[model samples]
Target: APQIGPFSMSDGPANSGDMVSTSCSIVKGDFPVEILWLHNGEPIDQGNQDITITKINKHMSAISIESVAARHAGEYTCIAKNRAGNVSHSTSLTVN
Candidate 1:
């Protein structure tokens, strides 16, 4: 079974025009677990201008947004999937 660690934001609350990064870790899973990042229930592209995904290691990954705007405030979800099963973690981003 795949187990996902709790979601975490690099900084506390973010303000408009600030860069933000959110991360999650996979404790145990099949090799080469696939990771997906979603904002407000929609999938985010890998090399989007405003957002990007970074794989720190086989077990850790992060999503970074540059110059966040009001529209960026929402629920962010990190999903890890493998042959055995899948797991997910979510966090809310508030822009001031």
Candidate 2:
């Protein structure tokens, strides 16, 4: 479930034989924000999968899509949550 707050994310289009970059947008949250990424309803994060958070700020974030491939296609959810509230969004990734 996508948390609540000020947070957003996106994985750039399939590299198409090259690495791709994903960008995120954050609006405003009541408190701090936590970003959680899920693929096919599965937790995807550092030290676990081939995903990494490249940049994160007060209201925005960007991620790098590495080794783009066909199997790397799915849904990505960005959940932002804090002591105040929580929010979430999702995007689709297609590699061909």
Which regions of candidate 1 are displaced past 4 Å? Answer: 10-12
Error of 2 at 27 (Å): 0.9
lDDT of each: 0.84, 0.62
Tens digits of per-residue lDDT for model 2 on 1-96?
223333322345565555755655556655456666676788777774466775467655666666767776777777666776666677787877
Per-residue lDDT for 28-80 in model 1, tens only? 77887988888999999876788888989888888888799888888898888
Report lDDT (Cα) of residue 6, candidate 1: 83
Alpha-carbon RMSD to native, per candidate: 1.5, 4.0
lDDT of 2 at 45: 71
The pairs that clash in candidate 2 are: 3-86, 3-87, 4-86, 4-87, 5-86, 5-87, 12-22
Stretches of model 2 off by over 4 angstroms after superposition: 1-16
Task: Please give the lDDT score for candidate 1.
Answer: 0.84
lDDT of 2: 0.62
